[model samples]
Target: MSEPLDPGPFFHGTKADLQIGDLLTAGFRSNYRPEVVMNHIYFTALRDGAGLAAEIAAGDGEPRVYVVEPTGSFEDDPNVTDKKFPGNPTRSYRSVHPIRIVGEVHDWTRLTPEALQQWRDRLATIAQERGEIIN
Candidate 1:
């Protein structure tokens, strides 16, 4: 077997309120493209990256970042790794299996309103341009 890509105390970000032991599974809609039902659940080793995902996740609920443990093997996310940012600098991964919520983190840095708006505007532009999600 191949060696694992990352030894992560991984994190998943979302706007959903969740408790410890909750299982985050694949088949959810993509946060970036609602039209796509994701085949894999994505996570990252970088806490701040997860924080950014949580902030931009599509929902009315408050953003949350959860410490998660993958229930099965995972691989580097092709969407960002090599495809966009080379060398997996984002430390992102995706799993077809579920990831269990081990705990919640409360101290992640929040984006400023302007920064958030900038991200929103960027996403909007991508959507308008019909960017592919590499699902």
Candidate 2:
């Protein structure tokens, strides 16, 4: 395990073999929020294989990194936006943006069903802060 680039409760890693339940951070920029750091979990894949390359088709070229729940403090960060929300907020999975893999998550694979549910609930709360629902 290594120290995360940004502050907060998050797991960070180098771009290696990513798997479901792995929490990762990507560098992203949005019109509303620039130089924003987002966290995502590798939920599923469209292709087959273990490493990121395998997730991409033979000719697709683009890394098909499908993830769930992107949470951030954008709503609370004065640097990112003027709007501030104390609670860390999450946007819909549909709002996922193209990002550069900055770090990978070290913990997450051993989550129990109950633990997973708790995480989901937390994520839902964050999403609602953005006025979006996670299905």
Cα-based lDDT at residue 116, candidate 2: 42
How does model 1 score by TM-score? 0.94
lDDT (10s digit) by residue, model 2, range 33-92: 223343322222111211222222233342333333335322223321234443323211
Per-residue lDDT of candidate 1, residues 6-47 (tens digit) = 888899899999999999999989999899999999999999
In lDDT terms, which candidate is top? 1
Candidate 2's C-alpha runs over 4 A off are 1-84, 87-98, 102-110, 122-130, 133-135
Best by TM-score: 1
TM-score between model 2 and native: 0.24
Local distance difference test scores for all models: 0.92, 0.32
Tell me the spans in candidate 1 whose CA falls farther than 4 Å from its real position.
none
TM-score of each: 0.94, 0.24
